[model samples]
Each structure stands twice: as structure tokens, then as C-alpha cells.
Target: MVDTKLKFGVHIRRAADKAAKMTTALSRLMANTRGPRASRRRVLMSVVHSILLYGVEVWADSLSIAYHRKRLAAVQRRCALRVACAYRTVSHEAVMVVAGAIPIHLLAKERKEVYQKKGQPGTRATKKEESREETLGRWQEEWDAAQKGQWTKRLIPRLGPWLGRSQGEVDFFLTQLLTGHGAFRAYLHKMGRARSPMCLHCGDAQDDACHTFFVCERWAGWRRAVEDELGRLQPETLVLKMIESDRNWKRVATFARAVLSEKRMELASQGPASHEGTSSSEED
Candidate 1:
């Protein structure tokens, strides 16, 4: 599917369209409010991504163009959002991280590298693993340097350990904590949907992710319960602690769900008048 200019734009667009349809067909399984997130991620990678990247090695170099990269990325972003149970407004980088999925461009490059090494002495599995490690390393470096999603970065400073977790699940509430794009007051103010960024429960400080999770006196009892079992909760070491064991992960997740659920209910009870100046546009 090459153009007169010998560009792979047609192929890329066709692949993206097919993948988008496949994603929609499988929407029930990958819907944010239903099904196991891990299973949804598997379906996305095996079905949607396979269709999108079919024979990617042949046209991998075309991904160097930003337009081509974004075309494919948009498809992957939709699937990742569902896998992470994240809001649509979440940044691509942050949602991909929370979803434990690699970037589409990097994956295409990895496949290309693996295909190039097919004739080498090593087995294909080993070559693919090597390419995956290289791609993940590159992604980690980019994540560290990214300026957007600072809230997510604070929680998950390293992507490797978070991706390797065998337990715990990424549901909507947990995604809210990780991405800081949920029903938080500060986030609402940024979107022009709230009059003040002050905490709805405490009314003393701006209700951002960090303040809600670690500093808010309103949730002091909940935090104390979690800290009693998980030792101490620090933003820098939170992910590490969560991934340490299934008990630790569930404990933290439960705390987030309890607190954030109440917060959501509180905000809803305030009625539409509380959000009088709601904006149609939202920033990443």
C-alpha cells in the first residue's frame, strides 16, 4: 500500500483503521468498567496490535516521521486507556505507563530489529527479548525526562518494576490516583469545572494527587490504616511498596478506592452549580 511518492502512508492508515475496528469489536472486554484489565491488555496486544503492525519490519523506517508515528499511536492509545481504566484526558505517556504497554513506534522498531537478527546465531526468542529490553530502556529514559504527567512520574519513577508486577489490578479508582486526572479538586479547577482547587473534605489546601493521598487530614484515618500494614507511604517509594506483595498492593488499592469514591460522591452531591464555569476544552 505505497503511494506514488513510495511512502507507506496508505499502509499505515489502512492498518490503523483495521486495528481501530478490531478494538471497537472487542470493546466489551476492554471497557473501563468491566472485565479483567490483564486479559484486555492481552487481547489488545494479540489481536489489535498484531493487525496494526503486520509486516511492520518492511516499513519500520517510516515511523521516523511524526505523522506516521502519531497515526498508529492514536490506535494504541485507545486500547491502553481501556487497559489502564484511565480517563480519556490522560496523557499518552502516562496512560501507556499505567497500562504497562510499550509505545507503538518503539515496538515497530523492536520488531524490525528482531527480524534483522533472524539470520544471526542466536534464537529468535533471545533476539526478540534483547530488542524488548532495549526498547524498554529507551522508554524509561524518555519517561524520566518527560515534563508532562509529573504526577504519574512521581508515583512511578521507574517503569520496569511497575510492569513486572504479578499481582494487583489497574481499575478506574487506582488509575485516578496514578494519573491525577480524576475527580480531584485541583484537576477540576485546571479544567475550569471547579471554583476552587481547595480540598472538598478539608478545605485547607489544594486537592492534588499528592495532597489527597498523603497529606490530607480528611483521609488521615484511611492513610493510617494503610501505613500500618505497608509501613510508610512516600510518593517516591509508593510503587515499589505496592508491587512488593499482593497484600500490600490490595491494601493500597482499597484505600484509594474508598477515599476517591467518597470524594466523587461528595462532588456529585454538590450539584451542577458547583461547576458553573465548566470548560469544553481540557489540557493534558
Candidate 2:
């Protein structure tokens, strides 16, 4: 063991001597350079000096001392992060290889793409902006002004008893009206993608709200029942009359909701079957 230690010490001493000679040579080269070349030479000399320093420390079997010196220098340079030491059972190089495998930039890019796709708008329409009280007031004011102007006249019963509803319930009913329009608009928006305004269910060329509600064969029978019940009112006016009628509005609303829900369920169930039949026909 003593002989082995002596042999290792001699090799380390020789390696340290070689590193010292290399540093001396770099210093001489920097001294020999002049003018513009001197800056480049100085940078090269510094790098060579650092390499020699690391080499000498390694050869002296004092890599820990060199690492601590480097960390202290980083602190002085304002680039050091707080670090705690642990007795790592694994090799340093192995730890470094594992750390390098982490795709941090890729993860960051993915997060950015997701944010771009679904990030909320900076400014959005708020509940206060479109609140029920505000909307009802605006509509009532317009209706009153119109009645005075003879421009548009709302049915009298609609304005009288309906105005007695609390702000929340009125807002809910207004929301339901807007939801119906939105559903219609959403269908048009999708059909527009194919450059056609055809109803998806009936394939009718004119797939506006009235057509879907009143003309589409898929819902014509249901529409007749609702219209007949509402006294053969125009399709556009049926909803208003139903809502305004003396009958229990809550029960009527529930019935309307049930019909809409069942129709949606029927469509959803039939969709897959239709799609499967189309695909099978194509294969044949």
C-alpha cells in the first residue's frame, strides 16, 4: 500500500509540473503579443490559466478544494445559487448526465402553446356589463320609447306581468332566450365552415333558426304540437306567448326543457349510428 501511494504521488507531482509549464508558456505568449492581438492573447491566457489551475488541483488529489474555490468565485461574480451539499453515492458525471436529459425548454414551449390556445382574454364581457337588470331596463326603455315613437310595439301582456319578476328570474329567462339564439348562431357558424347553410339533421338548404324550429322534418311534428298548444302562433312568437300565458310558467318551462333535452339525447344517440353506417358503406 505504501508503494502504491508513492507511485501515485510521483505521477501526481509529474502531472502538476507539466500543468505549471503549460501556464508559464501561456503567460509568455500573452507578454509577446501586441496591440489588438493583446486582448485576444489575454483572454486565451486566462482560459489556459484556469485549465492549468484545475489540472494542478486534480493532480494534487484536491478536486473538492478546486470546486469550492469555483463556487466562491461564482458568489463574488453574483452568479452563485444557494447550494447544500449531500454525500452523493453516485458519480458526479452520472448526475450531470441525468440532469441534462430533462427537456426544460420543450416543457416551457408546450406550456406557452397551451396558454396561447386557451388563455382568457385580457378584457372580457362581465356579468355586470350584461346583467339581467341592465338588459331588462335597456329593453324596457327601448320598448317604451318605441311605443311612444310607433317604431316597434311589444305585446302589452309581456311588459305588464313580466316586469313583476325579480331581477334574477328575469335574468334567467333572458339568458334562456339568448341561449336559444346562440344555439342557432352556433349551428350557422359550423355550417358556414362548409360554405353551406344546410341543417345537419335534415340537410335543408335553408337552415336558419326558423327553418330548424318550424320547417325541418326532424322537428316539424314537435313544432306542430308546441305551435298547436300555443294557439297556432308564428314560430317566432310561440315562445313569447308560452312564456306569457296564465298557465304555470314553471311547469311549462319544465316541459319545454324536457322536450329539448330528449331531442338532444335522440340526436346524440343517432349520430354514432349514422356515422358508422356511412363508414361501413364507404368500405363496401
Candidate 3:
């Protein structure tokens, strides 16, 4: 209806249109069939977000142009929901937090700052003389302000070098741990594919990934064998952080994945159930 407004709208529409198409085509990819929640997120980031953010900084100036800015913001909000696999009812801020995305308007604002800096004369020369300590301080300040509550102080860098070189199963295991998705029956049940969160083998307690892998009586033998392979017992505290850390994550992955695989086979054979009276003493 608004002709002039429609002209600049094409930029965001192009990205949104591409994203909508990708979402439609890859709807099945959302089935959690991939390695772990981490794997799906990587796909979302590496593929979906890559396409969505292409040339998005150009929309920076649109912020001054109200109509174009609102449209641009709307597109990004929708994309964030899809990327996070959150319900449409979720707040855009919540969606962005989970997706590890910044608000598009803010992103544009940040890009505009960089653009202005690039255009300025002698800015780089001035910054070149700044101390490394000053640079780190500035970086820490920005990282501290990245998100609101939990990840506000969190610095999201790449996974460690060993993870880049890990095998497929290890990669999947790490994905599960990092994304906190794939292995958590509570999560899958919440998503509706699983019937219950309780361990089919142990039966008394909830079957969260941590419980099954480390604390479950059912998997003690497997855990011992895994520890033998790793030449050490993996600690329960800071266990998930092991994925990001260089502390024998490969061994953790191999062991956790073996347990996960066995659990899957067990689930498939026994069918998903929560039996209060039946408690198997050992790993399936």
C-alpha cells in the first residue's frame, strides 16, 4: 500500500523470503534426527542464520527510516524464533537469547558504528597506538553486555580445537552436551516425541542426560568401562562444561555416546514408558 516504503523493504524481504523457503524445505530437519541439539543449532547457525544475516548490515541506515526499521525488525524476530525452535508465543527477546542472537536493530546500530569508523580518517592510526590491555578491556566490556541475564558475562567463542577434529559420534555427543538438548529425555518429552522423563531402566528418577551418564546406577558398568578407556573417572561437577573445555572431552564424548546409543536401542526395543514398580539394576 505504501509505495515508497515498499522499495527499501525488499532487502529484508529477500533475507526473510530465503529463510522462509529454507525452513519450508528443511522442515524435516527439525525432527531432532541429527546428532544432538548442538548439531541442529550448528545447522541453524551455519546454514540458516548465515543466509538470514547476509548483507543485513546494509539495513543499518533503515533504523533512521522508521517504516523500514520496523519491517526489518519483524523479519529478524521471526527468524530468531525459527532458529531457536521456540514457540511463536515466546517473546522475541527470549528467542534471541536462546538463539545467541543480538537484536537486528542493535546489530544494525553496531554495524553503523563500524562503518562510520571505517569512513573516518586517522581513526585506525589512533587506535593502532592503543594498548593491548585497553583492547582486551573494551572487548570484555562488550562481551559483558552481550545478553541480559545468564550469558551477559559469557564469552561465546568457538568450541575448542579438539572438537573441530573430533569424530562424528563425538561431535554428536558434544552437541548434545553443549546444546543441552539431544540426550535429555525431559526436553524431548517436553517437545512431545517422548512419553516420559523418567529412566526406563532405573525407573525411580528422572532420566536427564547427566543422571543417565554419570549418576545412574544402571550405567555403572558402562561408566567404569568408559573410565577405564579414558584412564580417569569423569567428574560430575562441571561435566557439561567439558565440551567447551580441553579436559578429555574426546573420551567423554566416546563414552557418553556409547551410553546414548545403547539407551536409544533400549528405548526403541522396550518402548517409551515410566514404570514405577520395575527398576532394572543395570544398564540395558
Candidate 4:
């Protein structure tokens, strides 16, 4: 009989090697270019991941195997390191989390979820010739409408040099703020997963994008480090006007990385039940 196991072993390595080359080439291309992190991140996802997952649906379960899993994980780490311009010593999970790149398995899982679903709710019907940007804009308009209920205006910063940091960081920050799919109690409650929408850290008020950064007492220690990078403590609201350039946004994104990371860790400590909402990427 043909050794299916052996063949898959070979197949995964070949896939990883190809992905590595693309990762390297893309890394080099990204290094010299300038643009918004989200834009670059989109390119990275469009290119590298598209290559890495070309036939993943058929073989994704092999990821449970230690050998194949390690090989692909290495590829992910190397690619992430290149994208973030981070050191080799950093853990891949941390690099990815900081960059806003989801775990490879999580990415695969998200893809499956998308395939199983139809479309986002409240979506405007589009022409068959609709571009991806058009769909995205419609979704954004719907999301912005829902957001108006909470804030008098959109408080999530949308200024640019989009930031000097990698697209992953910018992606992570924007996704957390605009998308309800994140590690926040408000999001969890909205999904009917959490017992309450209050801050797990303080348990006093609704935990939100702004409150997590400005109000949580559990994060005071981490907040100072973020503030030191910024010149002053950011006020409760971070309107786009405060961000002057991409350089300043990069600094803000960095601070965002630090604080949000702590909150992610805190949520992790609360156990698996806390992440029920975050486990799946569902439409709002």
C-alpha cells in the first residue's frame, strides 16, 4: 500500500518550504516599502497565507501530528518574525498575537466557519460584479451604525501614517475595536457567552475598547509603560485628531499592543469558558 502518512509528511514539508520562500520574498518586499499596516497585512495574508493554505482543507487534520505540526509552526514563526521585524528569540505565539495575526489553526478554523455560513447580517445586497472593497464598506457602514448606540461618534482612531508598526499590530487593534470578535467582556456578553458585560479586571463598569485601555485597574502597571512611550497618559477617549502622523500612530499601536496583550492574558487565566465567543469568528 502507498504510505499515505509518509506522503503527507513530504507534502506538508514541501508546502511549508514553498510558503517559506514566499514569506522571505514578501518580507524583503515589505521591508523597503511604506504604507498602512492594514494594507500591508492584507497583502501578506493574500499572498503568503494563500500559498500556505492552498490545499490545507484536505490535510489540516495532520496538524495534530507532532512532526508536521512543528514544521508548519516553524514556517509560521519565521514568516511572522519577518513580517513584524521581530527577533528570532520571541515566541511565535507572542509575535503573532502582537502583530494581530491569528494562530494558524485559528485561521484555518475561521476559514471553515466562513465556508459554513452564508453572509453577514444587515448586509446590503450587491451587484454580482461587486468588488471586495464595496462589500467591506457596506459592512463597515452597518458596524458604524451599531457603534453609534454606544458612542456619540466613532471613538476608534482612524488616522494614519496608518503607523510604522507591522500590519499585524494595526490589524489587531482595529479588529478589536470595530469587530466584536475579541477578548472583551462586552463582546462576550453581546454574544450571550459572558455572565455580564462588566470589566473582569475591576468588575465595576462595562469593559469596552476605550475602558480596557483607560479604566481597568488591573492594567495600571502595563499602562504606565505604554504612557511612557507616548509622553502623557491618553485621555479616556482617543479621537483621531490626537494622532498626528503614522509615526505617532505606530507609537499608539505599540502601546495598544502592550495593554491589550495584558487583557488577553487576563482573559486566558479566566479559563476556556471565557473565550467561547472568541473561539469562532461569527458575523455580528
If the candidates were sorted by their lDDT against the true structure, best first, what order would they fall in?
Answer: 1, 4, 3, 2
lDDT (Cα, tens digit) per residue for candidate 2, span 189-277: 34232234455677776554455454667766665665556665354454356456545344334434444454445435544421111
- Model 3, C-alpha of 241: deviation from truth (Å): 6.8
How high is each candidate's TM-score? 0.92, 0.31, 0.54, 0.42
User: How do the residues 156-241 of candidate 3 rate in per-residue lDDT, one tens digit apiece?
Assistant: 23222222334332243443443334445654555554678767667745676557666788889877876664544533333334
Clashes of each: 0, 0, 0, 2
Estimate every model's Cα lDDT from 0 to 1. 0.81, 0.34, 0.50, 0.53
For lDDT, candidate 3 versus 4, the one ahead is 4
Model 4: lDDT of residue 2? 44
Report how far off residue 149 is in candidate 1 (Å): 0.9
Model 4 lDDT, residue 184, Cα: 73
Model 1 lDDT at residue 50: 90
Error of 3 at 251 (Å): 1.3
Model 4 ranges off by over 4 Å: 1-37, 41-153, 156-169, 178-180, 228-242, 276-284
164-212, model 4: which lDDT tens digit per residue? 2233344454335433245677767766666678887677668876677
Better of 2 and 3 by TM-score: 3
Candidate 1, which segments miss by more than 4 Å at Cα? 1-7, 62-67, 273-281
